[model samples]
Target: MQETPFCLRVGHLLPYSMLDSNITNFTKTSTFILLGIPGLEAAHVWISIPFCTMYAIAILGNFTILFIVKREPSLHGPMYYFLCMLAITDLVLSTSILPKMLAIFWFNSREIDFSACLTQMYFIHCFSAMESGIFVAMAFDRYVAICDPLRHSITLTNPVVAKIGLAVVLRGIMLILPYPLLARRWPYCRTSIIPHSYCEHIALVKLACTDIRISSYYSLSVAFFVIGLDVVFITMSYTQILRAIFSLPTKDARLKALGTCSSHLCVILAFYIPTLFSSLLHRFGHNVPLHLHILIANMYLLVPPMLNPIIYGMRTKQICNRLLWLVTRKGT
Candidate 1:
């Protein structure tokens, strides 16, 4: 009898990334294949049930936030406007991959078309960039509200905030669009498989036959400029906000100021800390076990959506009250 296939004999234990670099080298195939949810077997109930439930929760949680903000007139402000944008971005981010991911997890299909994969990658980056931008914007809102209360409304007018929102979308599109296009231009090798659930820049580049140093450098540079700068601005904004609040005369006013900022700060911490942590873990701890790395990776991606609504509900009393009323009314 002929020897078994090398892939089969190995029981597919090697990282799918081994095939990625090979695939990037191929001249004939323009598209790539993704091997999703690494170890989830068809018979595995533990993974499927929980994964499905998490996706459902993410959608419902974000949708409820969207509804609460849209329905309540009191929630209309630059801060809440950014909150709504954040909610929308969360919805887009989770929905972009979860349905397809669920299909693969529940069923056994892993075939994603080239164009579709690129589209998914684009929106994933788009919303992620938008979220980063809005976080920065939220910091500014907080800064004005705390540091320059008299001019807060004037500084963050509805029109001005709207323009900021539009600019963020356009800039995100500009920043990320070139990546997927550049990705497509490079001919993929015939036999590569993406190990991750989504088309991450590093994961994709690892498979490239050509030197992806330029692409890697470009991605890192953009990430540093975008995410790093946002973090700096947010930190600075909050530092000023804290200083202003402490200097206030009334305990009640100071408490209120801190409370107003608390929720945004929670969401910001949840979003940024995990992101920075995961980056460090990936870069410095590659020798660690795959399961541990994947856990951190998923947390970095998924926790923001889970915590966003919680932050909104806790920090913005109007939102919490309205959401409670809505739920109670629906039940009635």
Candidate 2:
């Protein structure tokens, strides 16, 4: 037998990536396959039920809040206007991921184009930041109402609320815009499979071939400053509100004061608690199951959107009466 050439033998022994630097740069595939939940293909039938229910409730509930707020002249105020903004934002967030998630769970259609994935990732981070900002805005609204009731109207006037709304949008957009820009700078590897149901920032960044330390730092700093500072600001706002409430002369006055803030406080907790769990798990709890991470992440988006209307509707008499009147009027 003839001896094999040293050149061919040496090439065969070397890794494909070692042969060419360009070969290690990027994936040939332009689309990514989302692995919805590993080891649960057999149970997707069961998993999609609660998800579909939550999506339906979220959509219907938020739109109802918008409609009632718009129709009832009594509901036209800074609080209701802000609630409408929250509803719209929730709709955007729910729409961004839920449809695709259901398709993945029900139809196994998990492939997303690179551009589309980046777009989805952008909105997910954007709206989540917006929600946190909105929460802080709402807390400020509460503080003014509770602590400075006499000037609340003059302070949060139409022009002022509009400016606050604009600022919220700008804050969310400006901070999160860098994330996708930085993400696209890196080259993806051939295995463009993401291990989650949705196109998330971390999920996309994890697929990059280049060193993403700078990108990760940027994302984390933005998240910490945006979310962490919002939490602290909101807590401080409530502290002031509480001090003012304590100064009120009567028990009923104090309870009524706290009552108005209850619904918003509920929403803040619902939005942040799951978010904290998901963020913590994503960053630190590597040993946690992938399915659990996905579930918590989904809840972070779903639970607040679904529960906000219920919490506020039941807590706020104006909303409850309006909703009931609408239903009974339609029935008649």
Candidate 3:
């Protein structure tokens, strides 16, 4: 007799012969196949070029930000400390997805072990949450610096900043830990083919044969709780900041104060707009093309990390000056 197929072997152990048909396509193995992009498979190699470039820029830019902040003693303030945290989070966020995505696009190496996929999913979302929290902290730092300048030093002391950092990390961990844990409990009896580049939370959950409303509701709740709450905090902080800036007696004073916030505002918009657009597109863009959905999702991860360092490097006087000095010294 011919040997039973690997996927159906488990059915033979059961008492019923009729179960074989139901179990024929069940994924008994822990491997998942990642389709780089559903309909655009032919262009994957070309698509990888820009994706690789953006990932490289993200790595270089964030590292440069960390190095500059670390080396310059004058930058050892609350703002720069939060910036360092942001840089680290951005590095992790992009790194978690890009390499595997590039592997999928360029080499057609699309297999991701189940556990590895969960780990990737955890890192991507966790760091994204941490990045958002860090932005909130940075906004608070600006608010304190501008609105209550007299007590800024006392308010955001080293201990305070360190505690805030710890809270951001813990919040990210506590909140995002459920995604993988809940995902692990689901039975992926369906085919293990994921139709996107990375192991996105919703994408993985959809592969499960069980009812996934819990997972869906939990994911939505976390998004609103983390991103929504953080956005509100940031808005409130900036409102106070704007009020304080406009109340200043001199036009020059207002412009200078607003200048301090320009880079941060740009970074916030860069991060939020793409993220919200992608989330909305994923949920409600039923008529949208699958390739477009995947492309937007990939862009959301790439654009913010690439733009953040560039925005800060251009807008912040100190970082720009330091970069110029470093270049001139290297030239000599």
Candidate 4:
């Protein structure tokens, strides 16, 4: 029979005064539990409500971008093609995690099985890497359009763009494949309660009974490879773009080039900054509150996807006008 804690059964065990006294003398260690949102019960029905709303907005916004690109013949170009890929990535990225997150929140039980957790981790990392890769491709496309406008169409032709898209998908798959395999190999002899909401590789690795040195090294290496290298490449692309823009003889051409790039740059910054902060907090902020970590994680997932379409819509006059025209015609 399992021994019960004195506080939990004090009145019922009062008949055994000696045992009760012994139990009262014992000290317990307090471990952290994922209580989800504070001030709410463990199974609060409204816990999932906020995520559901965000998920809906993300879906609607990205779908609108997709529709605008498809419907407007004038928007057919290498830049818009890259934007479409980004919208598609955002849709897949949000869909991969939000449904399960919502289910746990609404049901008041944030329970996920081992297999499901690993799968979630895999898709999350995969899409995140893919987004990074696609951002690099977008920057390159912009560079070609502005720095080599006459050759832009010939350079980023349909076949070439399709190959670049394939490269992004392949790179994402290669980068994230190791994490799940390494996780599965670990002998999980410790407690299974994941302190965070999702199955993050670092968070889950912290629970493994096996030596995590290899896993940690690999995870950090991949983070540096994807995040660090991609940032450097993006910076280089923009530097060349700036140099080329300044060399332009006409002000109108300069403004047009800058305008084309402004939206993409805004979305890239929105996605990358939060992602870098989240990765840093996850790795180094072990002493921070669980809720703070959870908040950062949500921002990392939702902000990029949410802001992507908004950035494109507000900045791209062509896309904005097409959307407006569609709505106006519908009203008429």
The most accurate candidate by lDDT is: 3
Overall local distance difference test of candidate 3? 0.89
lDDT of 4: 0.78
* Model 1 quality (TM-score): 0.88
Clashing residue pairs in candidate 3 (N, C-alpha, C atoms within 3 angstroms) = none
Query: What lDDT score belongs to each candidate, Candidate 1 first?
Result: 0.75, 0.85, 0.89, 0.78
Q: What is the lDDT of residue 287 in candidate 2?
A: 74
Model 2: per-residue Cα lDDT at residue 159: 96
C-alpha positional error of residue 321 in candidate 2 after TM-score superposition, expressed in Å: 0.7
Our tally of clashes for model 2 stands at 0
Arranged by lDDT with the best first, the candidates are: 3, 2, 4, 1
Local accuracy of candidate 2 as per-residue lDDT tens digits, 1-332: 54433221111222344323422345433787787765566787688899889989999999999999989999999999999999999999999998998899889898888888889999989999998999999999999998888999999999999999999999999999998888888887534667688888877787676799988899889979999999999999999999999999999999999899999999999998898888898888877767777778888988888998889899999999999998999999
Q: Model 4 off-target regions past 4 Å?
A: 1-49
For residue 174, give model 3's deviation from the true position in Å.
0.8
Query: Better model by lDDT, 1 or 4?
Result: 4
| The best candidate in terms of TM-score | 3
Clashes of each: 5, 0, 0, 0
List model 4 lDDT by residue over 26-135, tens digit each. 11221212324433345446656667777888898899999999988898887888889999999988987777666556655666667777788898999899999999
Residue pairs in candidate 4 whose N, alpha carbon or C atoms collide under 3 angstroms = none
User: Candidate 3, residues 112-163: lDDT per residue as tens digits?
Assistant: 9989999999998999899999999999999999999999999999999999
lDDT of 3 at 222: 93
Question: In candidate 2, which residue ranges exceed 4 Å CA deviation?
Answer: 1-29
Q: What does the lDDT read for residue 277 in candidate 1?
A: 85
List where candidate 1 sits over 4 angstroms from the true fold. Answer: 1-31, 39-45, 330-332
